[model samples]
Structures are given as structure tokens and as C-alpha cells.
Target: MGNEETPESRERTDRTGWRGLLVDVTPLRTSPSFAKLWTGTSVAQIGAQITIVAVGLHVYDLTGSTLAVAFVALWALGPMILAGFVGGALADMFDRRTVALVTATVAWLSIGTMTLIAFLNVTQTWPYYVLAAINAASATILGATRGAILPRLLPTQLLPAAAALSGITMGLAITVGPAVAGVLVATVGFPWTYLLDAVLFAGAFLGILSLPPMTPEGGSASPGFSSVVESMRFLRNAPNVRATFIFDLIAMIFGTPRVVFPAAGALILGGGPVTVGVLTASFAAGALLSSLVSGPLGRVRRQGRAVTLAIAVFGLFTALFGVVLLVTGMMVGSAGPEGVNVPAVVLAGIALAGTGAADNVSAVFRTTILQAAAPDDVRGRMQGLFYVVVAGGPRIGDLLAGAVATAIALWAPALIGGLIIVALMLVLLRIARGFQHYDAFMPTP
Candidate 1:
């Protein structure tokens, strides 16, 4: 029989024109399973983002403290880190589908509980913290499992395209979720906004339930501390993958200044929740746009250099964003929503958009390296560690940003952090010369 049409075949045939400039949809069209999974994940993440923003706004509303708002991410840090390691092990040892389904169930239930708490008008912050931690833990597990499953759904050549597509999923979710959350909290209140998340989360069940059993390839170690240790040992030997993690940790821990947004809105830039939403959506919009034009990314041979350049750009824009905030802060001291400065807000938004685009490009390359370089049996564990950096780094940044803002000025964290990222990445480029020259045609970890 003649060969049937497939994504790989199409990829071999097409290399130029507008089709190459846009995100490759071949992965979605090639695998009905991946399409379902992508759709479900997109819907669920959007809901998750909505709750994330709503919770921050709610905490700020209740306490009028940015530090308290930062505590939301702070509270989840320990649990999320633990979950990432354990969840990675679970994915490696058991059927990945099962691990994902269980974690998604926990996340959905946690959202449900959060909704009930909001509806009851619980003023106590402790309960919210508890639920948020649980949800974060579950989400980390789900993310690890999902990341491990991607390679199974498509050929190695499509991994970059798939990674770009995932960026779009995240970009869309982040863009829409925060914007909607801000509006919903203003109009319908916190309870309804949370309820919407709980409802939208059911889409995850659709994706997870449809997935076939996916046991790790070439067999995996038993699930336990030893398995986690094995993954760590593997990471120690993998220089290229290690560089990806370190670079991401630097970017997220230092450069992520999201914890300052609530206060920036109330005291510096004004526009309240709307300003917070716009600032966040702007970042995601950049990611979405980058993903749309990511067709050329799949062609680049020097992926490691690409990642480094993208992150350097990320740091540049982050510092510029800080400058905007600093100038705007000088113009308006303790300004309320009525005193919103349109020009400053627009400039800040533009800077944030640049950061988002740069970060998304970095993420696409980082994810490609991790997924492509690692062995299947260990991929889940690698992904788990990746999620720890991806998710936990932000939590660390939240605490750092909150502490620095409390100690100094609102703009200090981003400005200082962005500068640190640039300097450290430059140092990394010198030390990790091997990683800098890593070729996509022959991936090594």
C-alpha cells in the first residue's frame, strides 16, 4: 500500500511561505487524541487563570495589603514543589493517563470547595490559602503528567511545533482568564467568578477521560523516594537540560513581578482590577502573538542560543516595565482608580507585552530541549522537575517581590530582578558554552 498522508509527511513537503510563518496545526490535525487533550487543557487553564487573578483581587480587597496578596503564591510553594517531584515519579511508574485523571479530579474538587467558601462569604483568609495550596499541588501533578504524554502523541520533528502550540494554549488562557476575572469580580462578585472556574474545569475531565493508558516506555522504576532521587541524579548528568532549568529559575524568580500588580493598580497606575487585568492580558497577548509567528522557530538549529537570546530580551523588557512603573509611581502617589494615567499604563502594557513574547519564545525552546533530550522512562520525572521550576519559581518571585516592595518601593523588585537576570544569564553563557552551542539535529542532555 502507498504511504498515507501524515503530519511528518506534510512537514517534509512544506518549508516556505505563510504556512511556515504560522503555528503548525499539523499536531492537532494528526492526532485526534492530542486535539481533545489540547482543547480540554486550553479551557481548563483559562478557568484556572481566572481563579488565580480573582483570588489575588479578593485578598487585596479584604486586607488592602500587597504582601497578603503575594501570600497566595507563597502558601502554595512548598506543597507545589513536593507535588512536582512526587507527581513526576507517579507519572513514570503508573499509567500517565491515570495520574493525570486523578490530579485533575483533585484540582476540580478544590475549585469546587473554593467556590463554596466564597459563596458563604468567608472572610477568613486561611481557608482560601489552604484550598489554593491544594489546587496548586494538584495542578502541578496534572501538568507534569501532561508534559510527559506529549512525545507519545507525535513524532520528534513535531515537538517544537507542539511546544509552540502549547504556548498559544497558555497565552490564550492567561489573556482571557485575567481579563474575564477582573470584569466578573467587579460585576458578579468573587463567588460567581470562582464558580465559573469550577464549571469550566470540567473540560479537563473530558480530555483526561478520553486519553488511553500511557505507561512509560522501556519500563520505569517503582514509585517512591528512590524514583525521585533517580530523576535528580539524571538531571545532574544532563548539562543542557540543567542549563534550561537554571535559566528558567533565574527568569521566573527574579523577573516575575506579578505580586506587585495589585498595589501598582491601587497606588501607582490606578484603574484598580481593570488595570491589573490589562497588565496581565498584555503579557499573554505578546505570548499569543509570538506563538502565531512561531513558524520559523521549528527551523532554527541553534535552539540553546535561541533560548538565551529570548531570555535576555525578556530581561530587557522586564527592566523597561519597571522603569514605566517607577515613572508612573512618581507621577501619582497613592492614586485611586479615578486617577489612572493612560499614557503610563499603555507604556507599561507595551513593555509587559514584550516580556511575554520573549518569555514565550524562551519557553518554546526550553520545553523542546527537555522533551526531546530526555529518555521516555525518565521524561515524566524531568517534566516534574521542569514544572517545579516553571510553577515554583513564580511563587518564590512572589515572596521576593512582596518582601522587596514592602522594604523599598513598588518598582524596586522588577527593576532589581531584571538587572540580575541579565547579568546572571551573561555569566551562564560563558560557563555553559557547551549548552550555548547545542544543536537541535543532535540533542544532548
Candidate 2:
């Protein structure tokens, strides 16, 4: 315990709270492979964001229906789930490096195909749907592979820090990526933005190539029904891991308010799409700031307790955002095209930022728990489930928010959903003894 404060730890923290907030950079310095992996994903994610937004813009440009643009996610959802399970099984069976490399190559090729479609100036909706689905499937695989890859790169004690670092990576990608994408699509057009994604995707290959061979210690299981059953059985006994997934789902499904942003921008806030972008990015911006100052998180002994509180805070902020919208809507009617409630917009953004910060804190602990507690052989499958929960939860959220918004007011759904999240999370934590008492220092799944 006396020798635990290494030079790297000293770099981020002191007795003072301000000094203790910086993210630890030890993972980057100690593990070059992890560093490469982190850097590669960070660079490529910016380009990925560009292509994602560009494709949506291209679709809306071709057909002026916002509903058609929503098809992008719907088409991809099926393939994304299939790939997650297959990818996890394959990762446990083969060398992790090889699995990542192959999946990354597929993802790269999908982007390359998009570039070709852009160059051809194809306006067909079917082709766009197909390519977007392919890209999503490949990305799902890549995420599971990377989740399994991280624990091997760093020691258990540093898993929390590594998760924080990854949070920072995600925060940056989500914060800056789409904003840049919006500008690029408006100025340079769509093809170049897609090409940038194709070029940047090669960075993932560099990271995969740098890793030492990582063969699973536990015996391999081939991808099929049997593998799925086996993994499911393992999870059935892994109460803590299951609790993590449930907690995340409750947070995302009830707290996510992304679907209402457009309504808020148009009807309530009045600033139009620009306002929508600002509000959307505000959440990620807070996440970025929180991750940068997450050095103190590693010291927390009861990570489950931390996650519980953070998620509750997230719910509270989400409710606050809804209140901002509700009050703004009352103060003024719909302001037609390009209208804005300046003060309300600012306050709404602050609430969203707070939600983002709390959510990121929960994410760091949840991710650390999965990586540290799960065994090497089963880690891939656990990670795959994690990806599914994480990726799928928001889509469910979108539908919930959208449907509820339709029935009631734009702000009412989020307000109701947030309250539901707070109540549900508290109930789950109180009932689930394993989750509430989960210790970071001696992790179990």
C-alpha cells in the first residue's frame, strides 16, 4: 500500500481536489500497444463520425424525409447484434489480434465501399441501407474485440484508469467529431468525408498489428447456438455482471432524451439545426471534461456504489433538462423557423452537460467491473453483451422518448423517464446485494 503511489499516479493527483482531477497517463506510457490502440481508435472515430453524419445528410438530401433518415439505425440493428455474438466467440477461439485485424479490415472495406458509392453519385436508398448495416456489424465486432483486448494490456489495479482513459477517447470523439462532420459536409461535400473515414480506418490496423499474440487461456468455443447457450449460462451465474448490464439499460432507456432534441430546437428553443447540434454536443462536452479530471476515481473501493450514485445523478440532471424545456415551452409558444430562447437553451445545455458527466462516471466503473471481474476466456462474451447493452439501450431509448413525446409533450417524456430511472435504479441497487457491495480491489463476476 505504501508503494502504490507511483510517479504516474503522482502526475495526476495531490492532496488538493483540483490537482487530483487529471486523468492518469500511465497506461499510455507503460503499454505501447494500449497507447497505439487508444490513439488509433481516437483518430479513426472522428472520421467515423464524419461518415455517419454524412450518410444521414446524403439520405435526407436525396429524399426530404427525416423519417427515412432514421432508417439508417433500424437497418443496422439486426446485423450489429449478430456480429456481437459471433465476434465474441471468434475472439475467444482465435488470437485476439487476428480477430481484431480481420474485423477491422471488414470495417475498412465497408467505408471504402461507401466512398465508391459516393463517387458514383448513387442516390438509391437501398444501397445506403446495406452499406450502413455492414459498417455497423463490423463496428460491433471491433468494439467487443477491443474490450477483450484492454485487460490484457494493463494490470487489474489500473483497469479503472484505463476505463477513464477510454472514456476520454469517447468524449473527444463524440464531442468534436460530429461538429467537424457538419462543417465538412456543408463545405467540401459528402464524398470527401466518406473518403476521410476510409483513410482513417487504417489506423486501427496499426494498433492491432502492434499487439502481441493474445490467445485465450480457457478452451475455445466455436460460434454457434451452443456457444451462445454456454455464454448465457455463465452470465446466469454471474450476478454482478448481469446487474451491471441491467443498471446500464435502466440508465440509458429512461434517461436518454436525444430524440426530443429536434423538437426542442424547433418548437421550444427556436434556433433550428444549429441549436440542435449545440445541444447534442453539450452532453459529450461535459463527458470530455469529466474524463479529463477522473484521476480520483481509481481510489474508490466500492465501484458499484459509485456507479449507483453517478447514475442517480444522471437521472436527476436528465429530469432537470426536461424541466428547462417545460418551462421554456410555457414561457413562449413555438417560435417558427430559426427561433431561439437564449437563456432556456443555455440552461438546458447545462443540465445536459451535468447528465453527461454523471453518465460517464457510471460508465467508467461499469466498464472496469466487466474487464476486471470476467475471466479471460469468458471476457469476450461478456464484452459482447456489454456492447449490445450499450449500443442497443440508446436505440430503445430513442423509441421510448419518441413514442412518449408523441403522446404527451416534448419535455414530459424525459421528465417522466428520468423519474422512472431514479426509482428503478434505487430499487435494483437495494435488491441486488452483489451489485451494491461489489469491491473494486477484489472484483468478482
Candidate 2's TM-score reads: 0.95
Residue 98 displacement (Å), model 2: 0.4
Q: Which stretches of candidate 2 lie over 4 Å from their true place?
A: 1-17, 333-338
- Whole-structure CA lDDT of model 1: 0.87
Candidate 1 residue-wise lDDT, 1-445, digit = tens = 0114465536633768887788877778777788899999999999999999999998988899988987998898889899989998999999999999989999999999999989999998988889999999999999999999988887666778889999999988877888799899999999999999999999898988888889999897675689988888888999998989988988998998988888888888888878887898889899999999998888888889889889988998989989988887776655444678888889989999999999999999999889888888999999999988877778778889989989998899888888888888788778878889988778888
Candidate 1 residue spans exceeding 4 A from truth: 1-9, 56-70, 116-126, 186-191, 262-274, 326-339, 402-412
Q: Across residues 85-131, which tens digit of lDDT does each residue of candidate 2 receive?
A: 88888878889999999888888988999899888999888898899
Model 2, poorest ten-residue lDDT window?
Answer: 1-10
Task: Give the 10-residue window scoring lowest on summed lDDT in candidate 1.
Answer: 1-10
**Total clashing residue pairs per candidate?**
0, 3
